[model samples]
Target: MSDLVYEILQLAGILAFAISGALVGVRRRLDLLGVVVVGAFTGVGGGIVRDMLLGVHPPVSFVHWPNLAVAIGGSLVVFFVHPGITRIRHFEVVFDAFGLGLFSANGAATALEAGQTPLTAILVGTITAIGGGVIRDVLVNTVPGVLTRELYAVSALFGAGIAVGIEGLGGDAWLASIVGGAAAIVLRLTSVARGWHLPKPRFTDERAATQE
Candidate 1:
């Protein structure tokens, strides 16, 4: 992927993540600083972790001013300017889904660019997608959505796989990213509406049966 396009995707993900986190903070009734802090962390947390796992020294997010600037700027915008942002139903899930799509697709592309195998690309992409949301939920003292939300992480996994597959087949990176992101978003929202869940374990199923 061209650096320009990659940068754009990262920025979009950061903004979405920041908005989501800020919304969560508002829901929790946190102070302005707290909201900004949570938003900043959510915006950059995934990318920082992804860089470390990929063995990128110093983590690009740490040294790059734009990453921090954009993150903080996004947080500020969400916290101060958009009090009604969370009025949208499932606001957190919606913005987080957007972040997940962009970040996951870009993560896979970055992994491929770093000369990693397809499997590594997929894993990195999935992690990049969910890592920030995990941090956000933790900070808010809530269960991470990926653990309980069906098709959440699955969306990232499928999207990442698709992105890698497209790149492997010599497709344009932008097209691959768009398709991958759209797939993840659609699957995630559909799962939400349909209440589709991954199958429970046999023991859980047996316990439920006994209860019944």
Candidate 2:
């Protein structure tokens, strides 16, 4: 992919991730600084971890201040502007699904570009998709969605799988990323809209009482 295209994807993914982070903070009624912290952390935590695992010093976001600027700015925009941005009756899931698609695909591509194996790429993709949200949930005192939702990690895995397959077939990075992202978004949105959940373990009364 062209340097310009790579940079654009990275920025778009970061912006969307940070926006969701800020929204989470907003929902929790956090102060402005708290919002920024949560947003920045959620936006870049996975990428930073990925780079560290790859032995890249300073990581991409730290090396380039624009990444930090974009994330922080995005969060601040949400903090101050989202309130006045005209409330959509259904904005929550809409933005959440969009962010899911953007970040998960970018994460998978980044992992593959760093020369991770296919399985590792998929794992990284799942981490990148949920890492931020996990942090956000912990900070906000909620359960991480992926822990309870069947389709969350599944979507990321599916995207990463598609990305690896496409690249293995000699497809362009941009095209692969797009297809992967679109697939993730569609599947995730469908799961949410349909209220699809993973099966939970059932305990017998005797086992439950014994455990208790």
lDDT for residue 190 in candidate 1, whole number 0-100: 84
In order of listing, the candidates' clash counts read: 0, 0
Worst 10 residues of 1 by lDDT: 80-89
Compute each candidate's TM-score over C-alphas.
0.90, 0.88
Report the number of the highest-TM-score candidate. 1
Which lDDT value does model 1 have at 77? Answer: 79
* Best by the lDDT measure: 1
lDDT of every predicted structure (CA atoms): 0.86, 0.76
In model 2, which residue pairs have backbone atoms overlapping below 3 Å? none
Lowest lDDT block of 10, candidate 2: 85-94
